[model samples]
Target chain A: MLLQIIVNGILKGGLYALMALGMSLIWGVMDIINIAHGAFIMLGAYCTYWLFNLWGVDPFISLFLSIIFMFIIGYGIQRYLINLVIRATIFITLILAFGIEIFINNLALVMWTADVRKVQVPYGASNFSIGCVTIPYVRLGAFFIALVIALVFYFVLNKTRTGRSIRATAQDLDAARLVGVDVAKTYALTFGMGVGAAGAAGTLWAVLFPINPMMGGILTLKSFVVVIIGGLGTMFGPIIGGLTLGVAEALGSNWFGTTYENFISFTILVLVLIFLPKGILGKSE
Target chain B: MAQRGATTKKLILGILIIAGIAIPFFSGNFIIRFFTNTLMFAVLASAWNIIGGYTGYASFGNVVFLGIGAYVSAVLMEKGGVPFWLAFPASGFGAAIFAVLIGLPVLRLKGHYFAIATLGVAEAMKALVDNLEITEGNSGIYLPMMNLSVKAQYIFFYFMMMGVLTLTLVVTYIMLKKKLGYGLIAIREDEEAANSLGVNATLFKVTSFALSGFFSGLAGSLYAFQQGFIKPESVFDVGVTVKMIVMAVFGGIGSLLGPLLGALSIEVISEILTNYFLVAHTLFFGAIVILAIVFTPKGIMDIISGRKKFGINYLLQNIRDHRV
Candidate 1:
């Protein structure tokens, strides 16, 4: 039973890691907390749901479509709206993200209503057992996809020219601008890419669980916990943070009931903020 | 010229106060109730101003204090048979105590970390309240209905909320006018400099936090009594915190009159929008928030006070100043 719980937690953590990576990237690079990160995730899930439900397109296939669509929207938002406040106090940017979240959430509610949705493939419920462990295909597929995406993201950041420019902009805005990097365009691109990751995660999420407009609020909070735990800026931070939170939440829910599960992450967040502001893997100041 | 300008400012303020005081008598029940609700939020936003505006800590969890106040008062009245008058102030004290206990560690965090930590604490408190038996868990506690006419009851609660608003404004005014107020703003401007100048940052922060808590608690108590229902979710709702912050930011952070104006305007607009837009009102509200933040980052108070010019040029200037 313990082994199964751990397995479930690890599987659950993978999706969380995927979600956190986007938020962490945006925060690490832009120094702005995108409070609307989960709203973008919600939008991606909706995209996947519509493509699957209407056209019978598989969620995995629709993932690319969702990412492309979300990238455009994300890019536009940053270019037109968020860019206006990026250079102000961090508080202004935070609140700007909040306004965008409120906008998207309410718009979703108006368009889609508050109904819950899920993507059900033929083998959604099918599971395989091996040596006293059971693995669901959806969960497994989602985990590996998340892992691959994180790996690819890390590699692109380290190896690619665009990645180098992003890193440069994140490090020093003036220096990057002096080098003809077009800091505004880079910020918008970074935001778009970060949100594209959210879209990908959301596509997988829709396959595994229910989706709704209100789902973003809790997901956003959970993503924050994951990012804070894993440490911001570092490549593997979300994976570590997500897994830690997943296991802690799983154990906490099992022992104290599901109502207390939320407390575990929040408690960890407070403790981390107070005791280890840099996080386990974050750089020391 | 300076003396005449000060006299005119004071005269306008005096007239505004008198008009506000006499409003309840002239207004009907619906308007009074609406005004009361706005006043309650004004108190909350004012409390937020003490820490968020003056001291530069953007707390996203002041609702926790509101929740604490509501639960404390409701429990006292329901279980201990305390009167509403006693329970109200008791709630404020309860929230203040909780703030002191948590503020010691939380105040040490700066910027976004501090904001998120307070948010975590608020959520944790809500979860804790959801589990505890004394608070009756999620089923919530209902107060005994007051034996008074409905109109009388509305009038009474209106006065109660008005009194709370007055207390908040007076406290905020004193905090800003006194040396302690300067210390708060000094810390906001540069905490390191404030510390170098021998301003005890930690104590002042905690004190401001507790003061913020006290008003939130008082507002919560009044809210519970006005509604006669106390749910952990309703009292500790994140929406309340969002509204307070939005109003404070909308009006003008770090100003005494800012929260009051912000609260009144937003509340009135929302009330009117609810009648027309129904479900879409919040969407429009969100859009307005974005536009407001983008165009008037400093706030409407700046324009009203002549610190910022009112025109397309002002908006363009704000965009230019803040854009990448």
Candidate 2:
């Protein structure tokens, strides 16, 4: 039973890492919280849902399209709306993100009434047994996909010129500007990249869990927990944070019941803020 | 000249107070209900201004106090047979106690961390409330129905809420003019500097948070009594936080009249939008907030008070300052 719970947690953590990656990246690069992130994830889920329901496009195949589409939307939002208040006070930027979140969430509600949806496929229920342990195929597949994406994202960040520019901008905006970097463009790009990741996570989530327009709130909170736990800016932070949270949540639910999942996550967040404000892997200023 | 100006201001204030007191007599039941709700929003927004605007903590979980207040009053009235008058202030005390405890640790966090931590706490509180037996769990608690007629009930709650609003405004006005207010403003401008100046930053922040919680809790209690029902979702809704924040930001942050004007105007706009668009009301509200934040971060109060000259140039200057 313990092994089963651990395995389940690790798999769930994989998806959590993906969701947190974008949020942490945006925060690291632009200092914006992007409160509407979960809404973008919701939009991605709908995209996959519609693709599967209307045209029989597999969720795995539609993930690419959703990422691209969400990237554009995210880029546009940062460039046009968020950029206007990016240099304002922390309160202003935070409130602006919140406004966008409300807009997207309500727009979703109007476009598609509050109905829970999920994608169904032939192998969605299939599982493989190794010894006494049972591994679900869908979750295992999602886990592998999430791992590959994380690795790819890390490689791009470390190996590419654009990635270097993004890192430079994250570290020092004025310095990057002195080096002829378009800080504004980099911010927009970083935001778009983060949203694209959220889109990918949403596509996977649609296959594994029930979804609706309002599903973003808890997911957004969960991502924050992961980001805070994993430490900001570091590539491996989200992965570590996500795994810790997933295991903690799994154990918490097992012992305390499902209602306490939020309780457990929030407790960890508060404790981390109080005891380890810089996060586990975050470098002290 | 200054004395005459003060007298004229006092005269205007006196007239406004008389009109506010007599509003229920002349207004219809619907209008009374509307004003009561708006005044409650005003109280909440003003309370938020204490911590969020003045202290710069920007807490997103203040609705937790509202939830606590509602539950405390509801539980008292339902299980203990306490009267509404006693239950209301008791609820405020309950929230104040919780705020002091929670504020001690979380208030140490700065900037976005503090904001997110507060939000996380609020979500945790909601979940905890959902499972607790004393709050009746998810099924929620229903207060005993009042024996008064519908009009009387409306008028009673209206007056109760108005009284709460008056108390909140008076307290805030006095605080803003006193040492505590200056300390809070200094902390917002620079916490370390405030501390260096012997402002007792932590004490001021916690006190502001507690005061904010106190009024929010009272509003919640009044809300519970008016509705005759209390649920975790209704009282602890994030939407309540959003509305309070938006209204506070819309009118002006940290000013006495900002939240009052914000709450009244936003509520009016919300009512009008809800009537016409129904499903699209939230969308419009969100759009308006975004536009307002982008174009006028200082809020409408700045223009009304003539702190910033109102014209097309003002809008252009805002865009130039913020735009990349």
Candidate 3:
């Protein structure tokens, strides 16, 4: 039983890592918490849902489309809306992101209503067993896909010129400017990349769970817990954080029932903030 | 000339207070209820100003206090058979005590960490209330309706909320002029410097939080009594916190009059939109928040106080200063 639960948690944790990666990247690069991170995820889910329902596109295939769509949206938001207050106090940026969240959520509500949706892929129920441990095929596929994307993200950040420029801008905006980097464009591109990751995560999430316009709020908070647990400024932080949270939450729900799930996540967040303010792997300033 | 300006300000304030007190006498029930709601938000924004604006600790979960106060007042009146008058103050104290307990450890963190911690606290509190038996779990609690006419009840709640608003404003006004206020401002400007100057940062922060809790709790208590029903979702809604933050920021973060102006204007705008646009009100509200933050990040108080010029140049300057 314990092994099965751990397996389940690890599977879920992979996607959680994908979810937090976008938020962590945005926070690390811009020093702004994108409160709309989950909303972007929701949009991605709807995007996948529609493509699958309207044209019978597989979720896996539509994932790339969602990324492209959401990247443009994220890039535009940062360029026009968020860039306007990028240098203000954290509170202003936070509030601005919150406004964006509200706008997107309501817009989605108007467009699609609050009905929960699911991606009914053909292999959704298929599972495999290994030594009394059962794993859903879709889940395993999602896990592999998530890891692959995360690996690609890592490669992009470490091995590319754009990644270098983004890192330089995050490190020192003025120095990057002096080095002929277009700081504004880099910021926008970084935001776009972060949101594209969110879009990819959302497509995977739609296959695993029900999708709705209001699903983003809790996901956003959950990503926060994951990011904070894993620590920031490191590539593998979201992975570590997501696994820890998923395992802990699975254990907690097993012991205390599913009703205590939210409480457990939030308690862990507070405890982490109090005990490990820099997060598990975060470097001290 | 400065003294004359002060007197003029005082005259305007007096007249406004008088008009506020006389509002219910002539206004219809809907208008009276609207004003009461506006006053409640004003109190919330102003209370938030004490910690977020002046002390520079932006609390994202202040609705926890509101939820606590509502539950406390509800349980006292419905289960314990306590009078509203007694239950009201008890609710305030209960929330204040909770603030101190939570604020001690939570306030140790700074900036976004503190804000997120507070948000977690609010969520945790809501979950707790959702599961707890004494609060009746998620089924919610309903208070005994006041045995009075509809008009009388509306008027009564209006006065109650108005009285709380008056108390909040007076307390804030006095606090901002005293040692506590100066200490908090010093902390806001530079916490490390304030600590080095023997400002007792923790005490001031906790005290500010407690005071903020006190007023917000009172507002929640009045809200519970006015509505006659309380639920975890209704009282502890994060939307309330968002509204408070938006109002406080819209008017001005650190000023005494900013939240009041913000609440009044935002509420009025919201009311108008709700009446006319109905389904799109929230969308418009969100758009307004975005525009307000982008254009006037310093807030309307900046323009009113003449700290910023009201022109396209000022708007462009703000964007230039803040944008990448």
lDDT score for residue B306 of model 1: 64
**DockQ for all candidate structures vs. native:** 0.82, 0.76, 0.86
In order, what lDDT does every prediction score?
0.89, 0.89, 0.92
Ranking by lDDT: 3, 1, 2
Candidate 3, superposed: residue stretches over 4 Å from native: B1-15
iRMSD of all candidate structures: 0.8, 1.2, 0.7
Question: Looking at candidate 3, what is the lDDT of residue B276?
Answer: 91
Quote the positional error of residue B63 for candidate 2 in Å.
0.5
> What is the per-residue lDDT of model 3 for residues B1-324, given as tens digits with 9 covering 90 to 100?
445545655665688689898999999999999999999999999999999999999999999999999999999999999999899999999999999999999999998889989999999999989888889988998997898999999999999998998899999999999999999999999999999999999999999999999999999999999999888989999889999999999998998888988898899999998999878789999999999999888887776665445799998888999887
- Pairs that clash in candidate 3: none
Off by over 4 Å in 1: B1-12
lDDT of model 3 at residue B281? 86
Which segments of model 2 are wrong by more than 4 Å?
Answer: B1-19
Error of 2 at B255 (Å): 0.9
Candidate 1 vs candidate 3: the DockQ winner is 3
Positional deviation of residue B313's Cα in model 3 after best superposition, in angstroms: 2.1
Give each prediction's root-mean-square deviation over alpha carbons.
1.5, 2.1, 1.5
Q: Per-residue alpha-carbon lDDT of model 2 for B126-237, expressed as tens digits?
A: 8889889888988989997888999999999999988888898899889989999999999999999999999998899999999999999999999998888878888988
